[model samples]
Target chain A: MHNEKVDILLIEGNDYEAKLALHNLKKHNLTNNLLHLRDGEQAADYIFATGEYEGRDISNRPKVVLLDINLPKMNGMEILKKIKSDERTRTIPVVILTSSRENRDVAEGYALGANSYIVKPIEFGSFSETITSLGLYWAIMNQEAPYIPNNLWQSISEA
Target chain B: MKNILLMKFFSTAAVTPKRFHFSAQKSEFEISHIPFKDSGVSVVNSSGQLLVAKQEIDTIETKPVMRTLHNARKIAEDAIIKNCPDVICALDRKGRFLTINDACVLWGYSPEEIEGKFFTDFVVADDIEKTLKAACACISTGKRTSIDNRCAHKEGHSIPMLWSVSWSADDNLFYCSGRDASDIKSAEISLQESTQRYRSLFDYNPDAVYSLDLKGNFTSANAKVAELTGCPIDQILTMSFVPFVDPEYMSVAAESFRKAAAGEKISYDLVIIDISGNRRHLNISNMPMIVHGKFTGIYGVAKDISESEANKAELKKLNESLEMKIMERTSQLEQSIKEMEAFSYSVSHDLRAPLRIINGYTKLLSNEYEGKFDADGKEFMTAIIENTKYMSRLIDDLLNLSRLGREAINKTIVDMNLITQVVIHELKMEDNSIVADFKIQDLSPTVCDQRLIRQVWTNLISNAIKYSKKKGTPQIEIGSYEKGNQTVYYIKDNGAGFDMKFAAKLFGVFVRLHDRSEFDGTGVGLALVQRIISKHGGKVWANGKVDEGAVFYFSLPNS
Candidate 1:
């Protein structure tokens, strides 16, 4: 039930892109399971439970993070590095949805541990369709990383 | 009579007919004659040798001896009077010809006419004083002296003659021999004229003409050389060429003069210092001076070329600056092109964001308010959505065109058959409700940018299917053939083809041959195809007939 609650995290630089991406994901019936973070810094904070997201349950990791490269405080490559470096959220998938097909950001994003790189098309129809399929792929079809609750994690360590 | 007889006795005694050996006394003629041959008059025997003056000699020889002396005098006068090569004449103290030889006829005068004529009258007036001086000298010295004077002919022309005159004191007469000298005089005159012409040429020539003696010392230099040095000719002649030549070329001038003095002709370029101390370039040609097969000196001519040399240097400098200017302009153009590429990327990303939102909101409006809007409002929203979609496609096509200029080609071996099949399958899948009968032919492989070539296939196959879908069971044929050095791939479709006359407008970015009601699309497909094909160094063309079918072909390099 805890894994079912915190489903996907959307880190989008543009508000419109985030709205469309969420709209597409909600169309796939993943509305209650999705969380929209504004920028890479806020996304990192939400994942690590720091800054504005302090004292939050850190173990309730989302199934996937849809990251956009062009962000305000911390760009996607930096945030991807932070999440992939941490063992707690390292196994969670982070897919890049960006407006830029510029090879520099794409190559850097993958090297910094992005799972998939997708270009946000300007046509709303195709844009929403790509996000919908990616959402279904990550939330429904994809297997989640094993989560060990606090009690179970402590006991497994003792054994 | 006794003197006449004595004359005949002397003649007989001086020229005896027989060999008579006589020894005469030193004082006079106390002589003894021993004649062994027969003698007309008998001489005495050796003991008594005296023979009295012959009383018979007076009777026998007076008339004959007198006649013989007269005949000998006439012979000597005749010998002096006749002349062939020389005109013989006798002149008095006043230089009058008393007796003239027959050779006077050579001057159109007879001996009788010239006799008793004043010899000075036949002499040219210009030579009269000289002739008179020679006559006086002849009388005083009584020796042969020569005079070259012109003599007047009877025809009013003068001929040069060389006269040899001598005085005979005994006869109180001067004898003269006159010889023609016309040829020698004319030869001397021509030689003087030739020397004058050569001197005029040297003085008037614009170039500096100078001559050096065998020691490389200046003998004579023309006025031009003086003008160059700003010195008079006499002063230039006194000065050697060394002072006028620049110090850098002083040794070279010396070497060249040495060569010329050795009877070798040489020429060289040198720099000289002018009166103002400015350096001037000069070309000097030196040749050995030979006179009558004897080495005389070296003659040379110099020409100033300083202005022309300066022009050559200026032209070279201009050419170098021109090359630099061209390079600068080329770099400026390249900078503008790079800035334009960045601007194209900005247009692609930033401009499309709003268009996407416009399109996304319209979709939401239609979905949320399914029946809230009337049919007119709904249709208007659809139009907005369609127009937004077209604008997005225009941005993409424009980006592709500008990107072709910016990005380098990433070439690979592209298989046309597989690419055509993939394009066809993708085109049908994008609109799966449509049916297409694709006739694909054998296609060869090519080396090109795989992504751009795939774009080419995508635009072309989609165009074919979109246009031909109006027909029942739309038929499309994809084939390739070989042309000169290239392979041409064609897509033929049974479609609503365009008029051939408007084919030129088909590839324009915003041009649409068909109405929006008949076909729903932007006109960027063919333009994108053209851009991609040309980026691969190829060409594209389309042929279509109204109500018939259409075929689009594109070419690429075989390798």
Candidate 2:
């Protein structure tokens, strides 16, 4: 499991929301290497290779991280800060997918360096369409940052 | 003896037969005769002495003439002593009264009773030593001495006496004259006491008290004046008050001084810099010092008021801080309201996800198990989907109502006639099958939020059309008029109007007058209209009668 390369990292606390997002992503055949974490802490552990995810390869980063603002344990904002602040994972695209349309949340999400901010729709058809389009755009169409070898990235960070 | 010598000479002259002039030349008498006109004659000698002459000799009657001369001298001595008002007395060397005048009776003593008594016996005990000392001084120095002493009267009361005594060396006596001084003594005592009282009043006063001369130099100042200026009394007396006065108040001080010097009393307030260089505010009053009807200079008193000025400044600062605090609290209240609205919006957003899931699953079940289910099962699924959709609509309406509370109204001048026309055109396009007569009147323009006012028109006109569609021939009338400072617009319909009793609840949220079977509505359109009008500082109302007609009105400020 630690040796596999992941494509999408979905951090969602609610079971129904997680199921819906995964089902929609699967229906579109976006990625087979998707990893779903129930809370912000597990997502941080898996991303930073700390605590339960210690000894995992430190450079096998995901292509995109889908985040919810309201989560158990560490919340989505703290996880975003952790992911964006680290040099190894800084280039990974973070998309904020939450049920909140508050102006403050959108502003805070963008201010913390979120790549994309999308509000989750309430109707099933709209929610399905939004999730499916997001998968297609981030996983298939958009170009990701060029990856550097682990030792080379360490040398660059040191410089 | 002199009278006898005069008698001898007159007897010799009476025997001579001529008018004789007697002249004494070196202890001898020279008698000469001149031509005589009568038997008895009188002449004056060259030394202005009187001489008597008689033609007949009278040597035998000389004794009787001497007796008459002595009696005449006695009468003259008695007249001099009887008329004098002062007590004139002669004292012996031993301080005894040798001879007292008739004026001794004024002291309740006759001259005869006082003549042999010691003078010290009549002097009061308190003054006996001073009186004896004056007598002794007069005798020893042979000079006149004056003393004030109380003399004991015979009636047991004392008289204040001022006495003058002289020592006569030849006679070995002291001649004394005394006068009553009771009135002058009492007047002097009262004057001294009053002067002391006024001096203390000036010294002990809390305010600085001082007097100036005609030259504006301090003539006299009390203890408080020295304390107030932080200067010594001598220094203040030498210096003019001009140096102590603050530069700004120099003119005011001069004017007050001029008024006081012109015989007018004046008072004023000024700031002064004391010797220690501290600023003090003083309220001063001055009075004219007049002596014998002439104006002199100023009298002043000053009270310190710096503390009160500072307190006034402090109170003004406190009032400003209080206003700032009120503003801060108001902004805090607004922030909390915004937070609460955000919480409700999130809650409404979160509620939709479950509803969507339910609607989605029910549809899938109905479509997938179409052949296996009965008619009742299909109907249940449909009911669930419809109700879920209705709930979703309710959430959206609630969110819109809450959002309106926080929305900033952007106001502009809008043409009510054009807004009504556009709304009517839209309503007709929405339902072309409905037939009605529309009466549109000239509507006034008003200042309002254009978009919100358009919503108000749409809600009112749509309500009018929906409620009147059952009529045989629906009639809808739209118009506006100027009412006071407001532009009032009304939409009237000849339709199934509500009862007048429930008119008060017409604009309340979720309050519907008719059953859902008769009328289809969310009961939020009128509420939204009411809220929009209120936000624009306007009003909304309605008038109705069951089955007759209904008229809905809204008013906006003209400016």
Candidate 3:
């Protein structure tokens, strides 16, 4: 039931922009079963189903992960690295979308195995189009890995 | 007219031998032959009366006939003497006067009164020797000759006269006719006046006009031409005209002269030496003057051409500078195009990505974890959202700087202090947190793009407020003064100041002298200020030391 509840994970910081984007995504019908993580460390620990997310099912990896760059604690780049480095979540798709098209973020995103990098458009119409396309692509078209039983997946992870 | 003829005949008779033919009437003795010379005789009657005398019937030589002839001649001569306009006088063999016409009598004494006076006494002292010599020659040769002499007028001044003399063989008398030549003297005076008028025109004409022979000798020149050429007229007459020309222009001068002498009108420029030995440029036109189909000399007129040549040189330099300025403007336009491209890339790359992250994950948060997170967790997420929105604002300021750099200055009259006050008032309306002490001084008007100048004031005033936000009471002073011909304005702020060592990078885009944490700006405001001021033919500078308040100064063109 716990694994079924967390269908997707989203990490973001800037509260106003985060709220605006959240409103936009809710209209797209993609984030109905999604979970929100505020900082890099929380996002990393929860994905591995350790720390705050311990005792929860780790076998059910989310369909996708959305990340924002400006954060209160550990930033988006480190969160992306933690997910790609682990065997259990390495196959999970991570999409980085931010207000800053800062060179460091784009380069680090690619280096850390980010699946997609998108810059938020300023105009409302273009932002809507960008979110709708991202949702359709990752949720409907992309082929997610089948759920591995906890015994097999965790035993392989322990080894 | 008849009196003039009789006087002419009597004067001729006094000089010529007396000869007459007369006829006798009932009581009048008429000499048929009276030898005007002594070789003939006249006849008389038995009553001792005069009668016609003749050596033969055709020629007369009788004493009565000679007396009758002499009486008749005297009567005719008296009529001529009374009517002649010119003075007429006779001189004896000894150069003494024998008779005079009425004109001569009127001119001086009567014929009887001066009959024996020597002719030299009537002549002026200077003319006496010449008169005596002419008289002696006339008496000896008995030749009809004329001489000009100054004779004493009745008023005691000398009157010029021409006298003609001949010998009379009959009475052995020397006969003379003297005519006053005062009319000739008046003609001479008129001739002198015309010569002086011609000379004055030549001497005072502005253009130097002179005549030169084919040999390059200056044959004639006006007084001014002589002075301009630095040669006396007498000296120039013998010297070569080529000597006054600069050595470099001598060949050209010679060729021009040769062409002119060959009947070709030649015009050219020459550098010549003036009276003070200073070189002068003259435009000279030379042409050959011919009289009666014979080439006399070359006539030339010269005017100064130095100023015109200098003006041409100045115009050439100005054209060169204009071309250089056009080239510089074209290159600047090209550079701005490239910078605009870079700015577009910055918009797409640096600005949009943060906005995307903020929008995307913030959406994920509220949607996925709305009821799950605590209030503090939600608050932290909201702060991230606020900061990213501000980041977009910073990017816009950067784009504004790029745009400001590219636009051309649309110049108009602007009052800088007025603009500063408006910006200050706007800022005050937005944030009333800090007390701002504005010491605004009077500002002069200058020609500038008012809209661009508004941006300048907005940037500087906003920056002052932003930098001084933390201070308990912000004191900002806006003032302007004239330096040389330009109006310089400054915004002084009581705030955290920056080091002056980084002044070199003050106007560079996004170059912040202060830390972003210290001042809430993208560092594009001052750069925009500088760009707008620089476009107005002005410059901007910042003066600040650490911990001291900073002052930003900019200047605008006076006109």
Error of 2 at B488 (Å): 2.6
* Model 1 stretches astray by more than 4 angstroms: A1-9, A24-65, A72-94, A111-113, A122-129, A132-159, B1-273, B279-335, B368-381, B409-454, B457-465, B468-495, B533-544, B550-559
In terms of lDDT, the poorest run of 10 residues in model 1 chain A is A1-10
Best-matching candidate per lDDT: 2
Which tens-of-lDDT digit does each residue in B330-386 have in candidate 2? 899989997988677666757876787787667657766788889998999888987
**Ten contiguous residues with the weakest lDDT in model 3 chain B:** B25-34
User: What is the full ranking by DockQ, best candidate first?
Assistant: 1, 2, 3
Off by over 4 Å in 2: A1-7, A24-31, A48-50, A54-64, A80-94, A110-117, A141-159, B1-339, B369-373, B415-444, B461-478, B492-496, B517-520, B547-549
Computed on C-alpha atoms, the DockQ of candidate 3 is 0.11
DockQ, all models: 0.33, 0.22, 0.11
CAPRI-style quality class for the chain A–B interface of candidate 2 = incorrect
- True-structure Cα RMSD, model 3: 17.9
Error of 1 at B55 (Å): 69
Candidate lDDT (C-alpha), each: 0.78, 0.81, 0.74
lDDT value for candidate 3? 0.74
Ranking by TM-score: 1, 2, 3
Pitting candidate 2 against candidate 3, the one with the higher DockQ is 2
**Per-residue lDDT over B1-559 for candidate 3, one digit per residue giving the tens place of the 0 to 100 score:** 4334444444555466454333333333322233455434444454556454334424544555555456556766667556767767666667777777667654476666666788777788899998778767876777887889888866798888877877776677777777778898789889999988877767777778888887878878877677677777888778877778899899998888888989999899999986688887889999888979999988888877768878889999999999999999999988989877676656855566557556557656765889988999888877776676667767778666666655777887777667877877787788776477788888887888888888888888888877776778888998889999888989899887778888889888778777666676777777788778877889999898776678999998787
